[model samples]
Target chain A: MIRTEQAEVVYPNGTRALAATSLTFAPGAFTVLLGPSGAGKSTLLRSLNGLVRLTAGKVVAEEADDLREPHALRRHRRRTGMVFQQHQLIGRATVLANVLTGRLGYHSGLRTLLPFSATEKRRALDAVARVGLIEYALRRCDQLSGGQQQRVGIARALVQEPALILADEPVASLDPATAERVLSLLHGICKADGIAAVVSLHQLEFARRFADRIVGLAKGAVVFDGSPSKLGRAETLRIYGAEPADNDEDSEEPLQLKTGTHA
Target chain B: MLAPSAGHIGILHEHRRAVLRHAGLVGVIVLVCFGALWLTGFFDAQRLIEGGPALGQLASEMVPPDFSRWRAWVGPLVDTLAMSIAGTALAIVISLPLALLAAPNTSPNFAVSQSCRLILSALRSVPELIMGIVFVAAVGFGALPGVLALALHSTGMVGKFYAEAIEHVDPRPLEAARAAGASRFQVITHAVLPQVLPQLADITIYRWEYHFRASTVLGIVGAGGIGFELIAALRVIRYDQVSAILITILLCVVVVDSLGAWLRKQLK
Candidate 1:
């Protein structure tokens, strides 16, 4: 299990991205972080792998030293896979080459200069097949569609054989159907592999559908932490800091007035 | 109505002022151009008309370019080509590391990046011809000086281009690599190089083409090549031989440019 001890993040420009908050991510559970934009979802998710250096406190993983130690941090990172919103594949490289990069941490820098071993190649190929992109394995990533590219990103992460997965708005750029498909693929993989996943998402529907547990945030602090069925309308309002638009007539009047003033 | 009309008049006045300002700037530019022409005696129509026959006579002398000396020109031609190829290879060797050091994303620290940039600028401040003269004086008259000059001068330009390419790579892939626990060197090889390889190749080939032309000029400064033979012919008033050498240089340049184009296509 990976956990943070009151970990917080304040960027150099003085933006309080995440308040001092502690949480534990258990193995074999899929946790979804639900929040509005800029509500510390990404900040908290990134801190788990030491990607966002916390301004205060530290992250601890089972059997590992404090993440502040470079050696321990690298070890933590090797077993942690991160998915990005932009899919982040090296566009000029083939899908196979991009997936093989996941195995880089398993070898020394000098050893990676040579071609990967056959076992490693087989593993990358298997990941590609799992993503259902076996036919496009040798094709350049730039030529793939956005959905396919995100799958390539997933394959790259999968080849790491990670114990934990962190995804930040991974489907924010895709269409509704494609988004659902990508999330399902990721959710299925994490379930089958028993990898703990901490995925931040903007869509409440997807979160409620796929999450084993839901953690909600607002203004850099968690407002609700429970199972998806337990997330009441009040809890949703607290997490988003607003009411659902369809039922909020009072809110609609104020919104219209604000836009009128702007005009 | 009166107040609104006054505001309209105020707007029109502002527009008129802007127009006047633009007109004044254009007038000043035209005056400076005429002044420069006058200073250079470029307006002397009488002298231009009178010089036509002199140019015609020079052209006449250059016709029927002497192929008699072609046998001796081969060695110098080869020397020029060799100098350019060797110089470009050496420049690429030096520039890649310097570029990596100078790029803000890859540099170890701000001081190293700034110092590397300073070195590139200092190298670039001197032209290849000037550097060729210095190298010739230092190494004595030979093709060695030409090669040295081309490499040093080209490094300045090639390194800056390479640094720019490296600096602009998509940072997302780098983040992904880092998050995957790849070492810094591993991240660079897998993420950075793959993104910028084609752009870097294009820059190197373009620089090689430019260096080929510059190497010929280096030969004029006692760095032995075809330019040296051309200059020798000029000294003896052998206009025909000079013309022949000029033609040879043009043909070689065309060949080099076409080769570079083909290589760039292959890279793509």
Candidate 2:
């Protein structure tokens, strides 16, 4: 299990992005960090991997070295895969090449200068196949649709063979249907692999549908943490500071409880 | 109402002052331009009119071109081409690391970045011709001096352009690479280089085209190229031969430019 201990992020400009708070993520569990924009959802997710250096606090994983040191941090990162909102693939590079970059951390920097080994190639190809982008493996990423690109990003992350996966607004830019499909794919993969996943999302429906447990935040503090079924109207108000205008249509069934169906 | 009116008048006064300040700056610029022209004797119409006949005589002498020494010219022409290619290749080799050091995103620290930038600026401050003369004096002439001059001068320009390209790359990819546990060197090779490679190629090709022309002139400083032949022709008052050499250089430049354009398209 990975956990933060009073982790906080105060930017150089003196903005408290995440207040001192602690949270734990267990193996084989899917946790969704649910909040509105500027609610510290991203900060909390990034803090787990040290992407956002904690101003005060520490992130510790069971049986791992201290994360504050550079060597330990890199080892932690190698075991932790991150999916970005922007998809972050090199546009001019082929899908296969981008996915292969996930294996970069596994080898020495100079070793990576040469072509990857056949075993590494096989792993990347398996990842591409897993993400259902096998046909587009040789195609440049820039040619793919937004949804397809995000799948490539997933494949890139998956090739790392990480124990923990952190996705920050992974489907924020996709359309509603595509977003749902992408999230389902991610959820199914993590479930089958039993990799811990902490995905941050502003979309109420997605968080409700997929989260094994929902951790809600408002203004840099965790307001609610419980199973999806327990996140009710009162809890939503506490997390959002007001009724979410977009969820009025589905307010009657706030927690859709679609988690087990996909898994 | 009175207080609001006073504020409006104050804004109006501020706007007028700003306009006057801009106008005064323009006036000074124009005055300086005219003063420069006057100092350079640009307004001397009498001298220009008197020089017209001499220019016509020189042009007349350049006609009925000589190609008798065409066989001897071939070696120097090849040397010019070789010097440019070698120089540009050398510059690119030297510039890549320097650019990495100079780029703010990739540099190890502020001091290194600033120092690299200072070096680039210092190198670029000297013209290629001046560098050629200095190299000739140091190395005792020949194509070696021309090659060194071109490489050093191009390194300054190419490194600066390369650093700018590196600096402006999308930071998102770099962040993604770092988050994946890739080392600094790995991040640069995998993320940074891919993004900037095309722009770097474009800059390098453009510089090569420029170096081809510059190398020709370096030959005039005893650096051994077609310019050496032109200079020799000039010394002997062989105007016809000089004109022929000029034509040869122009043709070669056109060929080099076309080659550059084709290479650019291939890269794209």
- Per residue, candidate 2 scores C-alpha lDDT tens digits across B187-254 of 99999999989999999999999999998889899998998999999999999999999998999999
| Per-residue accuracy of model 2 over A1-263 as CA lDDT, tens digit each | 89988998888877788889988899989999987677788889888888889999889975354578888888888888899999998999999989988887887857878988999999999999999999999999999999999999999899999999999999888887888899999999999999999998867877888999999987788899999999989998888767776533223222322111121
Candidate 2 residues lying further than 4 Å off, grouped into runs, are A247-263, B1-32
DockQ of each: 0.73, 0.60
The whole-model C-alpha lDDT of candidate 2 against the native structure comes to: 0.89
